[model samples]
Target: MLAALRGIAAPPDLPLIQRRNFLRVQIDAIGVGLASAAAPFLPIFLTRLGATSQEVSYLTSMPALTGLLLGIAIGQLLQKQRNIVRWFSAARFLVLLAYAVTALLIEVVPSAWLIRAILLLWALVTLPQTVVAVSFNVVMNGVAGPQHRYDLMSRRWSILGITMAITTAVAGQLLEHLPFPLNYQIVFSLLSLGSLISFAFSSKIELPPQPISNASRTNSVFTRLSHLLGQIWREKPFVRFVSIRFIFLIGTTLAAPLFPLYYVREVKASDAWIGIFNTAQTAVLLVGYFAWTMISRARGSRFTLLVTTFGVSLYPILVAHTHQVQVIALIAGVAGFFQAGIDLVFFDELMKTIPDGQSAIFVAVAQTLTHLSSFIAPIASAWLSDLYSLPIALTLSGIIRFLGFGLFLTLGRKDS
Candidate 1:
C-alpha cells in the first residue's frame, strides 16, 4: 500500500528510528538467509540445465544490466514517491512470488527446454528488483536518521552477514545430501516466505517527509547527470573515493563469470564444498563489519576502504592460483573480511559526499555509473573468456582489482 512509504508522521525521536533499524535487521536476517542460500547456486542451476558459459553470463549480468538501463529512470521516479516503502514491498513481493513459481516449474519442465525457460523466467521476475534495491536504501536512510546511521548500518551488515554465514553452511549440507533438483526446489520455495517476512518488517519502519527533488526541468536528465558528475569531480575527496570504487567494481564484475566455472569444472567441488566457500566468506563478514567499524571510527572510512581493498583484491587471484577446494574456502573467508569493510564503508563514503539537499539525485547518479560498469564488464568478461580462457579472465580480474589499490595511492591525504 502506498500509505506504507508515506507514513502517518515521523517518529518523534532517534530511539524510535533506531528501534525500526533493529526490526529491519531481524527481517533482513531471514530474507538474506534464504536468498543468499539460493542466489549463488543460480549459476550452478543453469549449468545443470545445460547452459553454456556465455548463457550463464547473461543471467549473472542481468541484474546490473537492468540497473544500468533502468536505474536512472526508476531512481528519479523514486524521488517523486511519497510511499517508497510500499513501492519497495510491492516490488519485492512480486520477485519472491516469481522465485516461488519458478521453483515449482523447475520440477515439471522438460530437461531440454528447462534452461531457456529459466532464463526467460529470470528476466521477467527480476525486472522490478532494481527498484527494490534503490528504494530500500532510500527508505533505510530515511528511517535510520543521520546521527544513528553509521552504527545502525554497521550492525545491519554484521547481522545479515552472520545470518548468511550460518544458513549457507546448512544449505550446502542439504544440497549435498538431497537429490538433485529437490534441494534447489526446497530452498527456492523458501525464498518467497523469507521475502514476505522481510516485507512485513520493512512496512513497520516510518519515514520522514520526502525532501522534494530539484530535478531540473529544462536540462534533460542526461544533462543534469553531466553537471552532477562535474560537481562530484570538483569535490576532490569524493572523486577519489568514487574512482577507487569504479575500479573495484570492474574487478568484481570481471571475476563474476569465473567463480561457478572454476569451482564446478576446474576444482570439481561438491555441493557442500560450494556451501563452505560461501559460508567462509559470510562468516568472515561478521568479523569484517565489526572490525571495520572500529577501524573506520578510528581511522575514517577512506582509510578503512583503502586498507581492506588489499584483501578484497586477493580473492580472484586466490581462485586463479588454487585448485584445492579447502584453500578456495579459506580464500573466500579472507575475501569476506574485506567485503564487510566495503559493504559498511561504501555507503558511509557516498553519504559523506552527497551534497546536502541532494541525497536522491546523488544516489541515482552513482548507481547509474556503477551499474553501467557492472553491466559492461560481465559481457566483456564473457567475451574475454570465450576468446582466451576462464583462467585468463580470472587473472585479468586480479590485475584490475589491484588497479584500485594503485588509484587509492593517488588519493589526497585529506580524503583519509
Candidate 2:
C-alpha cells in the first residue's frame, strides 16, 4: 500500500518534469486533436454521404471492434519492441497518409455508391489506428514515471482542451462556409498535416531503452496471450479497478454514436452551435486542470473520481431530455469540468495498480475490455433510441452510471 501511495507524489526534480511535459504535451495535443477533429465527425460525414442510421453505427463501432480483436497482440509487441515510440510512429504516420487520401477521394468520387466505398476504405484503416492507440498510454507511462503521471496527465489534457477549442472553432467555420463535401475534404486534409507536425515532435522524445524481457519466441501466439491473461488474473486489485472502470465507462460512452444525430435532429443544432458548445466546454475544461490537480492532491484520486463521475453522468442525461439547444450547450460546458477529474485520475490509478515495467500488460487488458464495451455501447444506445425514445435510453444510461459509481465507491475505498 505504501508503494502505491508513492505513485501519487510529485517528482523529485524540475528538469525531468519539464522534459516529460514537453514530449507528453506534444503527443497529447496532436493525438487528441486529430481524433476529436476527425473521428467524431465521421458519423456526421457518413450521413452526408447518404449512409443509413445502421450503417453509421457499424462504421463508428468498427475501430473499437478492431481494438478489441488486436489489443493483446499489440501488448505482446510492446513487450518485445526495442523502441516503442518508433513502432507507434510507423503505424500512425501511415494512418495520416490514409486520412489525407480519404479526404481527397471524397471529392473525386461524388457518386452515392462510391461514397460508401470510400467510407469502407476509411474503416479498414482502423486496424493500424487501433494499434497505435492501444500502445499510447503505455508510452506515456514509460516516459512520465508514476510520480509525474498526474502532472503529465493534467497538463496534457489541458493542451488537448486548447487544441480542440481552436480546431472546432476553425473547422466549424470552414464547414459552414465551403461547398458541400469540399469543405470536409479540405478540413480533414489540413488536420492530417497537423498530425504530421506532431510526429516530428514525437521523434525527439527521449525514453530510456528497454531490453526485451522474453527472448523465447518458440511458443505459438495463442499460447503467449493465454499466459498474459494468467498474469493479470493474479493481480486482484488491478482486476477490481478495471471492472469498476468498465461499468462507469459503459454508462457514459453509451451515447457516443447517438450524439451527432441527437444534436442535429432532436436539438436542431447548427454546425456553428457545435463549435460554440465545444469551445465553451473546452474553456471550462482547460481551467479545470488546476482545480482537479488540487483536489487529487488533497482528497486523493479515488474521492475526486467518485464525486466528478456523478457530475459527468448528468451531461448525457441532461442532453437527452432537454429541447433547448442553447441550454444543453451550456450544460455541455459545465460537464467538461467534471471530465477533468476522470481524465486525470483514470490513468493515475492504472499506473499505481501495476508495478514498474508492466504498463503495457495492464493497459492492454484495460483497453481490450473498453473496446469491447465501445463495440456494444453505441449499438445498444441506437437500438434503444429507435425502439423506444432516445430520451429513455439516455436517461437509463445516466441512472446506470450512478450504479457504477456506487460500486466503485464500495470496492475502491480501501486501497484509495
Measured by lDDT, the strongest candidate is 1
Model 2 clashing residue pairs (backbone): none
lDDT of 1 at 205: 60
Candidate 2 lDDT = 0.74
Summing lDDT over every window of 10 consecutive residues in candidate 2, give the lowest-scoring window: 2-11
Error of 2 at 234 (Å): 1.1
For candidate 1, the TM-score is 0.90
Best by TM-score: 2
Poorly placed runs, candidate 1 (over 4 Å): 1-14, 214-240
lDDT of each: 0.74, 0.74
Kindly report which residue stretches of model 2 are placed more than 4 angstroms away from their true locations once superposed: 1-12, 16-24, 27-35, 96-98
Q: Write the per-residue lDDT of candidate 1 for residues 28-80, one digit (tens) a residue.
A: 55675566567777788787767888888887577778887888778767777
Give candidate 2's error at residue 146 in angstroms: 0.8
Q: After superposition, how far is residue 172 of candidate 1 from its true place, in Å?
A: 1.6
Residue 110's lDDT in candidate 1 = 83
